[model samples]
Target: MATTAVINGERLWSALMAMAEIGRTPAGGVRRLALSDEDRRARDLLVEWLREAGCAVRVDDLGNIYGRRDGDDAGATAVVCGSHLDTVPTGGRFDGVLGVLAALEAVRAMRDADLRTRRPVEVVCWTNEEGVRFAPAMLASGVVCGRFTVDEAHAARDQDGRTFGEELRR
Candidate 1:
């Protein structure tokens, strides 16, 4: 027989509900458009949660956030898992938020279990994934993967003529 690790569903649900309140709208949707103030609050909350889970958190030049859990081996490359925190103008609660929260929960669960691996684990929150404010989704991942240059991603502008780089610097 195979054994499966069970996560605390109640805790996960609570975290999800808390996050849903960040950019909540009267229409029962999220308004965390990429690079908006609401989006920053959402990111800040996630970073706080990641830190609470004992992960070292960092944000890249392009505003992609990474939370890393160290393993026994210091030299091994990290195993990365994550999704974006940004959302459309009126996105659903589960769209990208769920993935980010789920990754956070997994890291929290691992910490609670005192689990260690040979390689560090990283949870990432890619920026501008929705491309609602900026154009061309997956901007941060593209920059990280070398498909797009950092300058290109930074130069991307939103509907209001604000640059991605400018907002990221704020």
Candidate 2:
């Protein structure tokens, strides 16, 4: 059977615009610092979208979001794609947001195309990737890949002297 997979650019653009509004700055940049209220809202919106697209969403202690579309073999490893949602104080709308939205669009396209694969597909959102509020970028991803420890990531402090773990729990 012939199948088609087409990305809805308009839908992707709409999603981007919607997210860009979350932490909108006066200078047209986003200030969605990690674990902040803006970050939480963005996470909630993304999770809602993922579930709407038929994915099972999970968030870790470090606040990494994974939206999974199961495959025929539930035990198989997943093919994942995504980027962080949190941004620096002056982060552009397209920097990390585009990759995330594109991945979301891919999942949506797959659903539209009725595509199937042996391995599950997932969209991931890494936490504190910019390190604006926390030190050392790629914090959550580094921990998952062993570059950093959970304690180290949690110990990171912001300008107000609040620990990363403290804000995450807030």
Task: Tell me how many clashing residue pairs each candidate has.
Answer: 0, 0
Give the TM-score of each candidate: 0.94, 0.96
Which ranges of candidate 2 are over 4 A from the true structure? Answer: none
* Model number with the top lDDT: 2
lDDT of 2: 0.92
Poorest 10 consecutive residues of model 2 by lDDT? 1-10
- Per TM-score, the best of the predicted structures is 2
Q: Which residue pairs in candidate 1 collide?
A: none
Error of 1 at 166 (Å): 0.7
Tens digits of per-residue lDDT for model 1, 73-155: 99999989889878787789888888888888888888777777779999999999887788899888899999899999999
Per-residue C-alpha lDDT of model 2 across residues 103-128, encoded as one tens digit per residue: 99999998988887779999999999
RMSD of 2: 1.2
lDDT for every model?
0.87, 0.92
